[model samples]
Target: MAAARESLLDAAGAALARRPWPAVRMVEVAAAAGVSRQTLYNEFGGKDGLARALVRRAADGYLAGVERALAGNGGDWERLTAVAEWTAAAAQEDALVRALLTGCWSERLPAPPRGPAPVPAQRRPEPPLPSPPDLVRIVRDRAVTALSGPGTAPAATVELARSCELVVRLALSCVTAPPGEGGIAGLIRTAAPRTAL
Candidate 1:
């Protein structure tokens, strides 16, 4: 069932890439996924449900990348640079990620649902896609938790959070108006405060 769900989602995502979500057909998605239409419905409930799941999955995937960048070996600022770089790059490569981060959902992409679908398969409803500000807060909090070494002072933690948010916001800026020569890392280096995250 999990495999079918993933395949269906992948198919839906691919179909979305080719055309607008409204134009993507259940039959084609099921065929592309090698699952029956009924199986697709069972996994996602319907197109709206699938859109919600897609947005949720994109958020999860982006956050997972942030975690990896934060967890990997690096100096304090380097870890944040990695996260910022990933943010810009992911938004460039994935329309869903870009839309979620920028709140500029073009007609080509799916507008996230208002709320969760009452799908039995969902068990628990997936959280709505984070707004851009929500995403900033989420990323800032994650960076603080990951980078705040044991027993850091609260004041220091607050300062570190500020640094982290600076990096994230700079990355967001890069997503909207790309940097000129040195790319996002250069932008971060120039714009980031003397303190590092």
Candidate 2:
């Protein structure tokens, strides 16, 4: 079942890369994955559900990369600076990451209408897709933990965490709108960890 789900998500992702989300049909995704339409619907519920799952998968991958960046060698500042540089490069190279960072998608078509049939008054609206800020918070929390790891005094942990948050915010800002020549490196260098007051 998990393999089936993965296969469908992979197919859906491929479709997304080639065209807008609205044009991606579940039947086509099923056909692409060699799964039945029922299997696709059973796994993802609907197009909205599939979209959420796709975004979640991408977000998870991005966060995993962040974990690697935070765990890389050198002091906190150096690791964070590396991550900032990485984020900038990734935003330019990957459309999904760019969409996650910028909350704007060049390839995403307009979302389809709620449903073909009218909704019941008692039925709740579908859950909203995870917001871009949610992704930021996940990265920030991980960074705080990474920044505060070993050798960090308990007293300084809070301030160090705040620094991590700032670093993440700045990196995200760079992703949203790339800096001018030499500007990104300067941003990262300036964000380097300082002694917590």
Candidate 3:
């Protein structure tokens, strides 16, 4: 069942890449995934439900990468640098990720629907999609958790969170204007000194 859901999402995403969401057909998506149309309706109540799931999947995948970046071996700044680089690269490669980070959903993409729909017990509702600032806060908080060593003082934790937010915002800046020569890593080094961060 999980496999079918993933396949359906993969098919939907591929279709979205080629054409706008308004043109995406439920039956075609089902056929592409090798599932029956009835199965598609069963998994996700309808197209809107699928859109919510697809958007949620994108957010989850990006955050998972963030976890990986934060967990990478190195000093705290180095981990933050990994996160910045990951953010830049991901926003460049995947439109859904870019939208999730920047909060700019073009008409071509399915604007995440306004509300949630009830689902089967197996399908838990993803938390509400974050605003752009909320996403930044989420990343910053996660980084702090991953980077803060045990027995760290509250004051130091607050400082670490500030560093995390700075690095994340810098990465987001690079997403729009892009960096000059050294790219995200260089920009991060300039903004985040290893001594303080």
Candidate 4:
């Protein structure tokens, strides 16, 4: 079953690569996968479900790449550089990642507006939007893993993790940004504090 699900996802991704998300019909995906429409629906409820799964799968690949880069020999700076470089490259190479970053797919198939149409609500509006990408949490988790070991200094470990996070986020932003913008190295110098040096 898992293999079948993965096969469906692979089919979806390949289709997406060839055309815009809006043009990608379930029937086409089913045909490409040699599965019935019902089977596609069973695995992924609809287009939105399939898109979400694609994004999640891409994210998993990115995180794995970062982990592999970190595992190689280097100090914090070198490892951070590796993570940044790998992430940028991955984002560039990944169709789904580009789709999410640019909202190319989501914009093509936007969700319907919430609340009653042509009716104003009396209740207070919802809270402000959340920040992008939850960098703090990702950084903290990576830092803990990288710094926790025998003979590792607590302060240095924290610093290294902080540096890594800064570099990684910077790289992500650059690779994901619209064309004509500069790369991650520019963002790194600006975001990382002097104390982090």
lDDT of 1 at 26: 92
Best by TM-score: 1
lDDT of candidate 4 over 65-171, digit per residue (tens)? 76877677976555666777776787679855544333344544323223322211332333221123543355446645764567768896677667666666667
TM-scores for every candidate against the unseen true structure: 0.95, 0.78, 0.94, 0.70
* Candidate 3: stretches off by over 4 Å: 118-123
The 0-to-1 C-alpha lDDT of every candidate, in the order given, reads: 0.88, 0.72, 0.88, 0.62
Worst 10 residues of 1 by lDDT: 115-124
TM-score quality measure for candidate 4 = 0.70
Model 4, position 110, has a per-residue lDDT of 25
What's the true lDDT of residue 61 in model 4? 77
Q: If both were scored by lDDT, which would come out higher, candidate 2 or candidate 3?
A: 3
Error of 4 at 111 (Å): 7.3
Candidate number with the higher lDDT (1 or 4): 1
- List model 2 lDDT by residue over 1-197, tens digit each: 88998999899999987888878888999999999998887776677667766766766677778888989999777787777777777767667777777778664733422343222343334444446787667777777777775787877877766776677778778876777766766875565456641
Candidates 2 and 3 compared: the better one by TM-score is 3
Candidates 2 and 4 compared: the better one by lDDT is 2
